[model samples]
Target: MSLFDKFEPLNAQYVRLEAIDANPFAITFDHVLSPTEAMIGDSRILLLGTNNYLGLTYDTEIVTKAVQATRAFGTGTTGSRIANGSYDGHKKLERALKDFYGRKHAMVFSTGYQANLGIISTLAGKNDHLLLDADSHASIYDGSRLGHAQVTRFRHNDPNDLHKRLRRLADVPGDKIVVVEGIYSMLGDTAPLREFAEVKREWGAYLIVDEAHSLGVLGETGRGLAEMQNVEPDVDFVVGTFSKSLGSVGGFCVSNLDDFDILRVACRPYMFTASLPPGVIAATMEALHQLRARPELRLRLIENARRLYAGLTGLGFCLGPEPSPVVSAIMPNPETAFALWSDLLKAGLYTNVSLPPATPNGLALLRSSVSAAHTPQQIDHAIALFEQTGRALGMVPASAATHASHHAAASPSLSVTSA
Candidate 1:
């Protein structure tokens, strides 16, 4: 059989997507105008797809820090920290993370995915067991495969199911680690962390909360869902990426566990991957400072999210359970979802289209992440656009268009801040 045979189904899907000029995966932004807007082809569109939760990507201070660091340390670190040598900035960033999380130790990885790969694979030894939420991110599942641990998946966000799964392995001779996310990316629903923590404690299992989407978007000071749920102590490790709220590149793992530094030598992904550029580290450090200092950003983000979520709901569309920065509208099917996505793009609105295996239960999603940078006017405009597109495509009732009319009319003209 040909090596390419396995991808025939995927190729067929791509062909279908191409037929309607709705290849969401192939979108290219010609120019990014700001955290809230970008140019696609010749048309400028509201940027609802990018996960810039706090919208610090275009902050002058962060950008200045990055530029200064690039000038001082050169463009990139040519080798891995283990091989070449650790930069002072790397250590400083790790220390900042430890202080931010109030943890005893922290380790930085070249990428967020690597952080999961290194930590999960390294911590779960051959004799260990990993109990993961069934809807855990692909990185978590991939990490399990890279290690020798016996893996089990419980029902998504169901603590009782997790408890039952752990009970089944009560007698299993190995360390137990429960892995989950603070905020799931697709649907934007948060895990019941307090309940999960209780389950973990009852079973004497370690807990890892991946806050990739929740960082800088949740909690009183943005320590993520563990802090918001008041279960920080129960979470043995907090893994996150700077790519999201921080608007930089890299991943980090913070923990109170003893001898955590040993992972520097134990994790092959950590050892093999090149270290992040000095500029990225500096930019991320500045972003972290901003995230902690500016709680208003979080407030604005949630407010924007509520507006969009409510607006979409008013338009007679099914959406995620709660109002979150990642506002996802459930589509009836992939075809309708693809058509809506294309129409939205053509109408100067850009949103993420999640389909098939990437989405939970093979569902189709028109996902849009609200940003602190988005003005109320922009949010209302997006709603109006969705109303128009949905109605035109029969995805929403014709009468649904009236729901957004008042808000759209009251919304002032769109004005995007220059990045």
Candidate 2:
């Protein structure tokens, strides 16, 4: 048997998607005009699926810093951080992260995925225990497998289930590390951090919160769910990414543990991977400054999310339980989800099409992440497009489409019937 045989199923799926020109995975924007808009083969597309929550990708200050750094430090850092890759920008960014989180130590990685991989895998040793949410990100699961720790998954967002699992390990001797995300990527649902924190404390387990999606989107100071829930003090580690609200590429872990710096030497993912370039580091630092300086961005982001969530809900689309930056509409099946995503793209509204395996509970999703940069008119236009497409596909009701059309009337520049 060939090693490629295992990919036959995926190849079949791609073939089916390509037959109708509905391959969501192959989409490439010809030009990104702004955080809320882009061009795909000359078609003006409203970007609804990007995780640019604060929408600072085009900020002049951030961009300027990035350009300046690139000019000063060249294109790339060719070596790993443990070797010759560590630069001043790297250290400054780590210090900025530590200061922002009020933590004692901060470790940066080349990518957000590596941040979880480095931290989770390194901390949980052969004899340790790794207890994570059942729907934890792939990075977390990979990290669990990378280490010798015995991995156990509790129910997603169910603190009671976590407690039960931890109790069974109570008699065990290994250290327990409980990992959870601030905001689940699929459904946009938030973890009850406070409840999980209580469980961690009750069981004397260390808690790690991956705020990859929630950073600069939650908390008064944009510290994430832990800060919003007033459970920051109880959390043992906070891991996040600069690619989201920060609008760059990198990952970090911040903690108050006195010996947290030791991970720099022990984490294989951190030690072996090349450090982020000067531009990314500079832009991320500037973005952090902007995130703290502009709390209004956070307010506008939540307001926009609520608008989209309400609009979709009014159209009879099932959505996440609460309103957050990430808003997703549940689909009945893969075919329907694929159709909706393709139709949405053709209608100049781009969204994410999430299928089983990556998504929780084997469900399909038409995911849309709102940005503060999106104007109310743009939001209305997006809703109008969804209504038109959903109605055409017979997924949304005719009456609901008629009712939703009134909201689109004010968006004079955008046409609801683009298709």
Candidate 3:
């Protein structure tokens, strides 16, 4: 049989799973939860790995708006945006985004992934060059390939590398799009926007910033990294999603381009895909408003992240820098990481497990997402669980080496100040 025809292991660590079944933390849940908790199969697990950065999923107002919209518009769109699905709901949501991002216009997509795919693939076509950060989202990679653009990769967050790459493209320019993210999804570090602004100034190429993880989590007004860095005016395009902080399931692109209107008709993904449903539209509008008006949500989220991050490090766990909404605990290898994952589940805490290929440099990760909804008590519980798991797995000794930052912690707590 061909390699493609062969069935692969669902989990490589199945042999050790006898331990999993015996775990007190192996769980199932069946109810709604706050920022730091979830009901899985039947157990209430602390949500240390949710992308619900703002905890807007459980907002009563958003739920009410979604329900109202469903009553008015029924269920699905039933057709693609180009055919018979373009509703007022789409335009309304787009307008709300435009005002929120301080842009003249915005275009919506089915998902953040598609937003990148449609915009990147459609704008930078054949004969173009795409200069992107190596750690950019997969959607960006796919879009660049689909665009058939000549791709050049710069080291993660390394502006000097970007400058060198741009220098090479100086002579040959059909069009070049410098792509980056407001916040990297994996390690949750932010891009150096000012350095990028300087590079683009010299290269004279357009810049696209993906704020899928940054929107509503950074910036004074929830406009994302561009706003936080005061580079919104410098960026050529800003793409983001309703999935993460937006508490919904749509995506958007905001640009000052008169060409943006053109992409609606020219872009195959936007044209062929069914438009967003009314409930998504209505709920998103509510979410965006809350994201802007309620800066407290952002502040609480940062505080929670800092607190959780710090607690993990203090416990001798190797973690990412500063408190980002995405806090990853990297393991030396996939086997060790999987072992840690199984152990964590046994302790009743669930997180994203990063293995090779998915994680660069053969590094595996136990990724946790901090949410504003996590109370001090919930965070403390999760940290205790981590320590327990680490000790049990031999990843750490009973007392550990005490050499690993004996007092490590997430960043300090945060508070959002309104404009």
Model 3, span 1-419: residue lDDT tens: 66743443643344355454522224345665775676766666777776898889989999999999999998889878877857888888889988887788799998888999999999988889899898888899998887878888899899999999888878995887899998887787888898899889888889999999989998888788888887887898999999989778988899997757989888878888788889998999999989988989888888777777777777667776556888888887766766777677656787877655556556778889987778767777777777777887776667653323423443442223321
TM-score of each: 0.95, 0.95, 0.91
Better-scoring candidate (TM-score), 1 or 3: 1
Worst 10 residues of 2 by lDDT: 410-419
Model 1 stretches with alpha carbons more than 4 Å out:
401-419
Give each prediction's root-mean-square deviation over alpha carbons. 4.5, 5.3, 3.5
In the range 1-419, model 1's lDDT, one tens digit per residue, is 99999999989988887887789998889999999999877888898899998899989999999999999999999999999999999999999999999999999999899999999999999999999998889999999999999999999999999999989999989999999998899999889899999999999999999999999887878888888878899999999999999998899999999999999999999999899999999999999999989889888887788788778988888887777888899999987888888899999999999986888988899999999999988999898899888888877787674534433321211101100
Q: Which residue segments of model 3 deviate by more than 4 Å?
A: 6-32, 400-419
Which window of 10 residues has the lowest lDDT sum in candidate 3? 410-419
